[model samples]
Target: MTRPELKTDPKYDDYDYPTTAPEVQSGHPGHTTPEQDAQVFQLRTQLEQAGYKERLDTLCMLRFLRARKFNVDLAKQMFIDCEKWRKEFGVDDLVRNFDYKEKPQVFEYYTQYYHKTDKDGRPVYIEQLGKIDLAAMYKITTGERMLQNLVVEYEKLADPRLPACSRKSGQLLETCCTIMDLKGVGITKVSSVYGYVKQASAISQNYYPERLGKFYLINAPWGFSSVFGVVKGFLDPVTVQKIHVLGSNYQTELDKQVPKENLPKIFGGTCDCKGGCALSDEGPWQDPEWKKPPKWEQPSKTSQPTTTTTAPAPQAASNAGTQAEIKGAQQAPMGS
Candidate 1:
């Protein structure tokens, strides 16, 4: 398909797109035109003038701009709200201090993790919704703890994971490829956990915009059609377009984007790690050749933990793409 025209300047028209994967276009990182760069600059200037101290990185400003469709005003408001929420939520403190000792138990009931890279070199994040046991999960952790974990994972995703993937693939990686397995999920189970899902979705969309790369709702039951139809109403068109809703026959399509060697065996791929792919935390970020400690790592504390799962006692957590919003479907949130 011909790319839509992007206003460009002779100086910035040489922006490179990845050769190994499909070209990332206008709305994402690594593909900005002159106008987009100006927009980011304007946003940065406004934020700085407004007294915002951090999160003014060019990539981040671009993300917020893309999320708001490049509307500087709306992007500014969103950025302001996100910063306020960050402080109120104590995100910086949680990233450094919060630990989820019950991570092992939590994973047993609700599986979420980064296993490996997709064919395009973006990290593959997998979640199993059909297996959720909210009651059991809550026994070991509260909803607040889960939110903290989500924030922590988002931070890790932005750092070690994406940077490592970018270095390994020789490209700039900004989003994630998500696979949400829904084999046994039914309305009753969904209803029981809707509240938590809503809260989670809000945090992801409101705080972490533009992180979805590819989304696959695999093993989707027949009943999910109506549910998804309703869910679709709540998501943006760009996000809805990125989602692939599939039933049991998801293997063929999944294999096209994620290599069988990299995919977990349970998902119709050849991979089955020593423990389990859900908890493996395997990816380019873990490769000694490319891996580096996250900037957030503290000298005194060696191990890093995340919301979905924690690092081993002696270790730290490691760290995708799409223009998709990841809203309403990809994340465990009943809704972003």
Candidate 2:
């Protein structure tokens, strides 16, 4: 049998496809803006001078800069503060060595999980806030351990999760699709967990800027929207825009962005993976059968020092290529 001819569109004949994981692209101001590029360069130079060259990458630096709206001094201070926190929290040691043996037990009381991919191919992170029982959770794990687990998950997201999603989608995916379920939450419950929630939110927003692509507050209780209206006044407009507060009738809207098969049965879908959906970690990134080819070329060890700062380490570079290839194959037509 003869294979069909591969067709090309003239419109995209001049399109320069991304060859690297975080290569600059249109529409993503955080990655492409001239000011951001300058800031990234400046930040890297400063980090190297401060002997923190090995501690962070351009992407991490950009996150801090974006968090501070590209204010050099503010971004530097934020980076320094994060470094201090990392030492105090032992985040590096946690990432390399810490193990959460109580993950299963803790999840039973507080459902926080990365289930599957949304329509845009971003990982879907769901947190059933109403299900959280601090008393029960603390029996298995302390708040400190929970925060450590959260940090580990965030590190994994930066390494394998987003990279894998980006590879599968044939584009850079630095953010996640989030669903915060507040079905049984009341004022009393909210007050009970206010401190923990506030701390977690601070860590995510201040330290991991641009990590939230889409946020859905589903199963919103009565008066929650009005409360959010007041709370949003203190949030960045860009952050507020990504959040959608939905009532019980959120299935229709959720279905538009997430396939029924990908979503869990509890969340108005049919997926019931073995063990449980909350712990399944099911997604394209976890598919062993879908192997991604290496698409990014490794930079030479002796490349110009200026360019070297932009390139990630050898392992990271390899992972980026692997991820992009996986996403490209999964999402795009063969020989397109």
Candidate 3:
């Protein structure tokens, strides 16, 4: 029997995404191979040199192309021609005789097996595939076969841990994509609006002593706007801008109430891999040269000051006419 096919052909050309030839790039440090891997990587670079930017995964894109325009047999042959054939990498490499931590029965009792008689009532023994006692291994289980060449289509998140060990940025974005769907907002619906959401989500998933910090997109796209103006005109834009304004304004007021020496210390280092983004920008964006808040001080409260300002003393007018004006000024209410 044949395996499952990756792409589904459509009856009509409803959505024709422009055909983009994928740009393949070489693997880094660990996975690079001295064989055909080099040739595939080199070809990928050449394609980039030719000036083409259609973000496509060579293998997956081919599957999509063959979808409706081509036949299944033809697709299969094409995959074969591309040498996309895959299988489990040698199991023996996984720590010799490690019958995979799965099959327990085979290891626990070597001769033990499960059985049932055939239609003829003869004894039949089935190989005990369970009870395999493999020791603990570090690598997390991954389902997809390794591809020889792949080009990143966007600013891929940097995560060095295995999928089992921790969630990487790409994984986090995919998760956010699923979450947006749950909120009844499709990816196509908020393609651009949800990017910051994805970024915040990925950053929050980073490993820390604390349970991975929670992802909270301030002014997230939880509300809708019904505008009646030309495009790009105001109307409060999205909730994010409002939240940003509120935060900055609040911080400014908060700073006014505290001593200049008590502000939060800013942090910056070459280690920050976020491309100069302010997510980790601790000290004031204005001047890193200024001294940071000392360890003993607490962060300034975000609320407004409760103390009232003293009113200016009422002045005595030199003449009666001026006296009336002075009284009116003294009587004026705060809001007025």
Candidate 4:
């Protein structure tokens, strides 16, 4: 099957948003190659034959294929295992019916939140591992409940977060920008939560492949590098490459990728939203005024008629023309 093309709208010409190409960029950490694409097609065909096609889309199939490096058989098995887990876990019902009434209380001890978007239009997820008091956390919510909440959040990321981002940027966004803050962390803390972290990592790596675009590990305490060196052994090289381990001096580096206004003040930024940055959930995707129309409703430039007067010009010139038209339209009539 040929790769699908993303539809672009001329109406969005003046919008200053990052654009991603339709096909996955090869050699990129989270992207798939042509060989992988072919394998994805083969896997999809097989899944369709087996009546599992409805459970996966091209993006979803490509994730499994990429997770196993385009090994069709292995990818298929991985996907099958994931489906089995989903059924047993009651993921669909959880997504619809599960509610964490203790979320606010949980957040007080363990910070896990989808705050905003990064420069690339991917959602920004922050998790302060050092703040985790598992004993206190479990007092309010069980381990099973926490995992359920994680799964629900993952579902939201796949749906509204990514789709909204795709609409806003006019591109296919499939991953998130993550900040795993390890401030005040030590060997004891790491060891204490190793099991839970390992389980969460396995779920993300196995079931939700290619969903991490950039990972920043800030406030690395003493000996954290050596500790990470041991941990990295269990992770894929691609996954390791996407992670940036930084010391307390992370502001300058983080500022390069994330806008100061969008970042939380606690993490060395300017913004301090009403409730809090972590829960503010502020971004183009979340803004009612800036949100893009759904994919099916968005008018593609190619589908619309182009007249001599309305033909698209060079990008810079088109933007200038659009601005001028808007300025003229908005200007009040002069008094005679």
**lDDT winner:** 1
Please provide, for model 3 over 11-109, each residue's C-alpha lDDT reduced to its tens digit, 9 standing for 90 to 100.
211221212111122221112235423333333333334332222233332322222122333332332222221113221122222222322322232
Give the Cα-based TM-score of candidate 4 against the true structure.
Answer: 0.76
Name the runs in model 4 displaced over 4 angstroms.
Answer: 1-24, 27-37, 229-235, 289-336
Best of the candidates, TM-score = 1
Report how far residue 17 has shifted in candidate 3, in Å: 27
Please, what is the TM-score per model? Answer: 0.82, 0.77, 0.15, 0.76
The better candidate by lDDT, 1 or 4, is 1
Question: For model 2, how does the per-residue alpha-carbon lDDT over 196-313 read when each residue is reduced to its tens digit?
Answer: 6656655564345557677788998888889778777666666667778899999999998888998999889999999999878877668654323222222212112232334222
Candidate 4, lDDT over the whole model: 0.63
Per-residue lDDT, model 3, residue 109, is: 23
Worst 10 residues of 3 by lDDT: 172-181
Please report the TM-score between candidate 1 and the true structure.
0.82
Give each model's whole-structure lDDT: 0.73, 0.63, 0.21, 0.63
Q: Residues 92-117, candidate 4, lDDT per residue (tens digit)?
A: 66777787889889888877777777
Q: What is the Å distance of residue 147 in model 2 from its true position?
A: 1.1
Q: Tell me the spans in candidate 2 whose CA falls farther than 4 Å from its real position.
A: 1-31, 289-336
lDDT of 2 at 87: 60
RMSD of each: 9.2, 11.1, 32.6, 16.3
